[model samples]
Target: DAGVTQSPTHLIKTRGQQVTLRCSPKSGHDTVSWYQQALGQGPQFIFQYYEEEERQRGNFPDRFSGHQFPNYSSELNVNALLLGDSALYLCASSLEQGGGYTFGSGTRLTVV
Candidate 1:
């Protein structure tokens, strides 16, 4: 069985552009979390989805958004991107109740 999976392993975007990164949770996982990790910094929580609804969010601006599908997959969308948005976007999956998370290798997004 595969763990979490992410697409477009690498990407580059310009200021004001929009980007969407996708993730598929591991088997038996129904919750998904998104995080952003800048160089030399730990991952910062962006948001979490369960039952197709956003359950929690971090300190990111409104430009960050996400969605969970019935199949437990999720997508993170960022709009009006800025240079500060350049970072490794990570996707983690876990049980809704609570447990250790399985993380994808992450999608490296560079906002030029």
Candidate 2:
């Protein structure tokens, strides 16, 4: 019954550096999705994983990649980060049929 959880609630990264963020899906869920939300903007989907493989992806640069493990936890990695990467990274989880998604508070990444 545990909800999704993300680490380091806040992150600070420099331009051109790479960063990796982690997420743990809700109990009994097998799918995980990542989204990026800029200030005042709705979340933009990055990718979704099911069965430990990526099932759907959005229009984002190759720099954005992710992985889902057997435990249903996930990790998002962004390489050559840009100032534009500064945003909130949210992780959501749902069942196979993909009902309403449950999102974490998100890790606020600030690129300076």
Candidate 3:
């Protein structure tokens, strides 16, 4: 079975702009979650989606949004990005039961 995959291993942007990152879940998985990890901090959950609807979310602003597709793939969109938004955007997929989660290497977004 295939594992999760992300694109553009690295990214660069400036304040006030917007960006989008993509992800594909591991085979047999139906839920996807997005996380942001700072250089020295544990990943902070952004949101989770199941059945194409956001089932749960963390303390993230409306600027952070996502979408899940029938194929179990996902995309994270951050609008009005700020320097503080610079971090590793990770995508993890698991079953609705909250097990078998697999994380992607991540898309590094650097804000200038």
Better of 1 and 2 by lDDT: 1
Every model's TM-score:
0.98, 0.96, 0.96
Looking at candidate 1, the ten consecutive residues that score lowest on lDDT are 94-103
Clashes of each: 0, 0, 0
List pairs with backbone clashes in candidate 3: none
Task: Provide the lowest-lDDT 10-residue window in model 3.
Answer: 92-101
User: Model 2: per-residue lDDT, tens digit, 1-112?
Assistant: 6799998699999999999999999888889999999999999999999998999999999999999998999999999999999999999999988587889989999999
Work out candidate 2's RMSD over C-alphas: 0.8
Predicted candidate 1, C-alpha RMSD: 0.5
Candidates in order have lDDT scores of 0.97, 0.94, 0.94
Residue 60 of model 3, lDDT score: 98
Best-performing candidate as measured by lDDT: 1
